[model samples]
Target: MGTSLQHHGAETSPPPVCRFAPSTTGPAHLGTLAAALLCWLDARSRGARLLLRLEDLDPDRCRPEHARSLLDDFTWLGLDWDEILAQRTLAAQHEAALDHLEARGALYPCDATREALRAIGRRAPDGGFAYDNRSRERPLPPGGWRACHEPIRVALPAGTFRPFDEGGLDLAQEPALAFGDPVVRRRDGAIAYQLAVVVDDAASGVTRIVRGRDIAPSTATQAALQTLLGLPAPVYRHHLLLLEARGGKLAKTHLAPRGAALGLSAPRLCGQLAACVGLLPAPEDCTPTDLLRTFDWQRVTTIDRVVRWQDGQLDATPADP
Candidate 1:
């Protein structure tokens, strides 16, 4: 029998390729800026290439003005990227991936409407209504998922798939229960975030994923999709989220005020965001470049940040332990 041994003189791994993909559904808010800053710092600190991907696949919400505004916001924050991609422009690739999943029997048309699912669904761990996977009981149409106009969902394998995170975030979950077979394509012909993100990251060779911890729950599902497609799984680090003091996340749906509208300069905004994640002692003026050399994941706080928007300014503190 051959013995397994570590190779001492193996070639070094390539530099990580990181990306910040923000949906173009709304203007960039404090949460958006903070997420982008963390991703930028993680990539730049390692001298890795970072990509700016505008997730404009959702036609119902994504707007051209929002995309342009986001590009400008990142530039103002001094976060540079090696390449820029718009997800909507990659429809062909997304379609090809769907085709692959369909041929593998990993996809099925989900005719269940949101109202229907919510009627008989239980609350999932992620707080959304868990899909019953009732569609799996029905046979595919004559031509399969493509022939049906219903939303397409990926049928994740039945097992507890866990993906490791460098920051020690637990991402072990049965995706079929946690996410309940996420949609890959909506009835409106829009590619869903889960499928598009998996395809885009693999195609772009994304090796490091750094985003808010709010997205940690989705990691297992994405990992499952990666395995189904025979793609490599990247190292992940889901950081702290900036939430409002009232016990809700700072989100676009809440109409969270934009950072620019607060009248804070780029340096001040960067410092504030850094402080929220334990990168700074307090909200002071600094640039992303200023923290590049000293950036270390060890300093980042795993706790969520409770922030308040008062008097047209932002203040942040750690959530109660």
Candidate 2:
């Protein structure tokens, strides 16, 4: 593994290499599309490389056709990526990372099943397990899974601190409090997202990352992972989330229609997205080039956008056209 990158300052590069990794669990949703566009703009403006990585870690949820459609949609928007990589392709490296962490005494065997853990009330209010450390003292059970969350080792600000995003969203207290001991690998023997991302980013030399702010809380925990693994932490810019009318934010799992289903040309689609994001002077039709002419980070909205994403278009305003 490469040495941890000094990503705290601007002197680290001409511009950090950014990436927009979309999961292929289903078709690309509006929120993911917006992220892809924004990340592309960030890299393009900086003359830096923008990578497209498919986060198809789940065999059951992610489909090959979903990935194909993801590429097709991005291409339709005229969004270009330098290199395309798949997370599943690097399974060996991810597993190696898990082993390395274990060798370094970072992981502890976890054999408790869902029923067993829940019996002890380990499930938290958020639907995720609070993961009481009762199993920590137990011997390594046969065919047990492994994890590591000890020493916390993460150090952030005392009170309020900007975790990510343009709005300066503050973590309640210490950022590390947001995450517990994370599962490095699943019982089914699959590498987890945290370890895989840190390891892959280090290998790819990805210095910058732009994604939705929904996962912003993980930054601190992942930072600790990078520190422990002796890998570089990339600069992160988590943008405001695009939410649905109710329920939850638009995601690939929402079963939203593909971008081609909108029936708009690439330039028109780009123009509409730019207008919705406060990038255009007006909501009139325009192209990616036109949006680029006036693109400025200062102009981006700092709050969440409730875009009524539909089959035809995105309604950013409550008043219907």
Candidate 3:
């Protein structure tokens, strides 16, 4: 066994490939920019390919202007990626992947209403909602929620349900013990996030996922989907979120000064962004070239930090590293 393991370790490994997948629902703020910078530095230091993916699947919320703004912001930051992909452009591909999962009996149709799900969640004693798989065998009436656990089987097509912990915190036996079967496709035909993200990542050949810590739960669902689809899971690195002065995280909707308000050129903004993530010195004046030379990934903090916007000035303070 040791010899076999040694042989496997001796095999050549592929080059590291990382991606920054950001939703184009709003302007790219400091939080998103910090994640992008870290991914860029990590990939560049390892001589790996850095790809940018626009997650614009939420058509109702995503806007073309936001996408353009994101591109502009990244360009201003002096970050370059090898390839860029939009989720809307790959709808057919994602649909095809869904069809494959459906064919394998891995997914089922769900007709649960938002209110019904919320009611179920409220009824749970532990405050954690569990789907009753049996609800899939028997159709629920209008305004009903389908159960993903058994003893109350709901109507579902013939398929093999994969075991998942939903929370992704434990790998225990009795697949249904932790999480009940989650819905992959809604009755209205809208794909769930778990299904969409997994399909997209696999199809795009994303090997590493870099993002904020808030979406860690979604990552677990993606991991389960990878196993069901027989695809390799990507490495995940959750960076600290940038917070606002009100003790809330900085969001695109926050009324911060724009490019003109900051009175900063492209080179200046690039330098400031580098300093925000502790990549360069915190001097008042530094050129973009200086930042490029000093860019280092080791200095990035693992704990959430604050990017306070006070009186038109942006102050970045590192939290627990």
Candidate 4:
């Protein structure tokens, strides 16, 4: 693992390596463009190498066409990365990390189904489910399987694996708070995102992570995994989400169709992205390069608002989108 340090003014430390990990489950959209652009700008400004990592570990959902489309989409947006990594090819590396955790007693087998979890949640008065630590220590139920486990017998650093508090940040506050011993390896014999990502980031020497605020909660989980695995934690920056007309974050699966109705020309899409982050010199006249030149981390607002674009109108949504 590599160290990431801050230097005094006029003194320079080695530039941190950054990475963009995108899931290839569907088509790339405006949010993807914005994230890639921000990451590229940040890496360029610091003279750092930017790597593109495809998060396609879930075999059922990921497709080659989706991966190819993601590459094409980023290229069209004028963003380039130093290296491309595919998660599927790195399964052994991630499996090793999971094995390491299991050996250290930091992970346990989880055999709970989605339906069971939903029932647990419904039974709780607060509409949230809590795993009973005592019950979790027991054997699996008949027909029910292991769901999640804890690091009971492992020696860990003090203050590690603590509860995460979102405090209205719209991100997962902490891994333990929402999930206890969340499945590192699923029943289907697939590695979970939490485990795979940590191993990949560590192996790839990633030091900075920039993505949408929607995934900020997952950071806490990743942070805990890093500490347990003795890997360096990356600096995190969660950007605002791009929204749709119904006040929902635009997911790859739910994004507007690409063509006449959405008016999604590469140039036009890039211009809208620039304006979303308040990088417009004059919305109609700004080019991608112009926006890139002016882009700086300091200029990024902490506002977690939803960016919305419709029939020639752009605005922010008060609700989560």
Instruction: List TM-score per model, in order.
Output: 0.92, 0.80, 0.74, 0.78
Q: What RMSD does model 3 have?
A: 7.6
Off by over 4 Å in 2: 1-14, 111-129, 139-167, 171-177, 253-261, 309-313, 317-321
lDDT of each: 0.84, 0.67, 0.62, 0.66
Model 1, 25-140: lDDT tens per residue?
98787789888988998898888999998999887899999998888888988888999999877788898898899899888888787798789768876788888787876556
Rank order by lDDT, top first?
1, 2, 4, 3
Highest TM-score model number: 1
Regions of candidate 1 where Cα sits further than 4 Å from its true position = 1-10, 253-260, 311-313
lDDT of 2 by residue, 242-294 (tens): 77767466776653535445666667667777776777755667655566666
> By summed lDDT, which 10 consecutive residues of candidate 1 come out lowest?
253-262
Q: Which residues of candidate 3, in runs, are more than 4 Å off?
A: 1-13, 122-134, 138-183, 186-188, 255-257, 281-296, 318-321
* Residue 29 lDDT (model 1): 78
Cα lDDT of model 4 by residue, 1-321, tens digit: 999897767965677899998898998876777778887887887789889999887878989899988998788777788899888888878767755765565544344555766666633222345432223344333332233342222122233343232223433344554554455666556677877888898898887777777666566667777888889877776776666666666888655335565756666767766666656643454445667677776566555446665675555544442
**Model 2 Cα shift for residue 103 (angstroms):** 1.3
In candidate 1, the residue pairs with backbone N, CA or C atoms under 3 Å apart (3 or more residues apart, or in different chains) clash, namely: none
Worst 10 residues of 4 by lDDT: 150-159
Rank by TM-score, descending? Answer: 1, 2, 4, 3
The TM-score obtained by model 4 is 0.78
